[model samples]
Target: MKQSDIFRDNADNCLQLAERAEGKPAYKRYSRMADAWTALATEQDWLDGEIPPVKVRVLQMQDT
Candidate 1:
């Protein structure tokens, strides 16, 4: 399996944990962990060249 897939699996696990969490703090922590894992998976995909990188736009200032 690819590293991104593994990361996504981890994110899924975190979401499951969040669902079962008893307290608000625990739930929030787990949710944050899931988000981080998902971000990692997306970054891994970029590193592996699975998708194109995001394009950035620069704004030019006009002289008054």
Candidate 2:
């Protein structure tokens, strides 16, 4: 299995925890953790070359 897959699995687990959380604080914390894990998975995919890197477009400002 790939590292990204493991990270995704961790994210899923965090979601589950959030679902079972007793209070708003716990739920929010777990949800944020899941987001972080998901981000890591996406970054891993980019590092592994499974997906293309995101391209940024810069716009030039016009002088008024």
Candidate 3:
């Protein structure tokens, strides 16, 4: 299994754990862990050329 696969599994596990958690703190922690894992997966995908580089656009706010 690849590193990205591991990260994806871990993220899924974290989400499940979060759902089972009762307290806000525990749930939040698990959710954050899941997010971190997902980020790692995204990085791996980028490195593998599976995903294109994200383009950032700055939108100007106009006052009406």
Superpose all Cα atoms of candidate 3 onto the true structure and report the RMSD in Å to 1 decimal.
4.8
lDDT of 1 by residue, 1-23 (tens): 99999999999999999999999
Q: Write the per-residue lDDT of candidate 3 for residues 1-64, one digit (tens) a residue.
A: 8888999999999999999999999999999999999999999989988889999999999999
RMSD of each: 1.6, 2.6, 4.8
Q: TM-score for all predictions?
A: 0.89, 0.87, 0.78
Worst 10 residues of 3 by lDDT: 42-51
The 10-residue segment of model 2 with minimum total lDDT is 45-54
> What TM-score would you give candidate 3 relative to the actual structure?
0.78
Query: Which pairs of residues collide in candidate 1?
Result: none
Judging by TM-score against the true structure, name the best candidate.
Answer: 1
| Model 2 alpha-carbon drift over 4 Å, by segment | 58-64
What TM-score should be assigned to candidate 1? Answer: 0.89
> What's the C-alpha lDDT at position 6 in model 1?
100
lDDT of 2 by residue, 18-62 (tens): 999999999999999999999999999999999998899999999
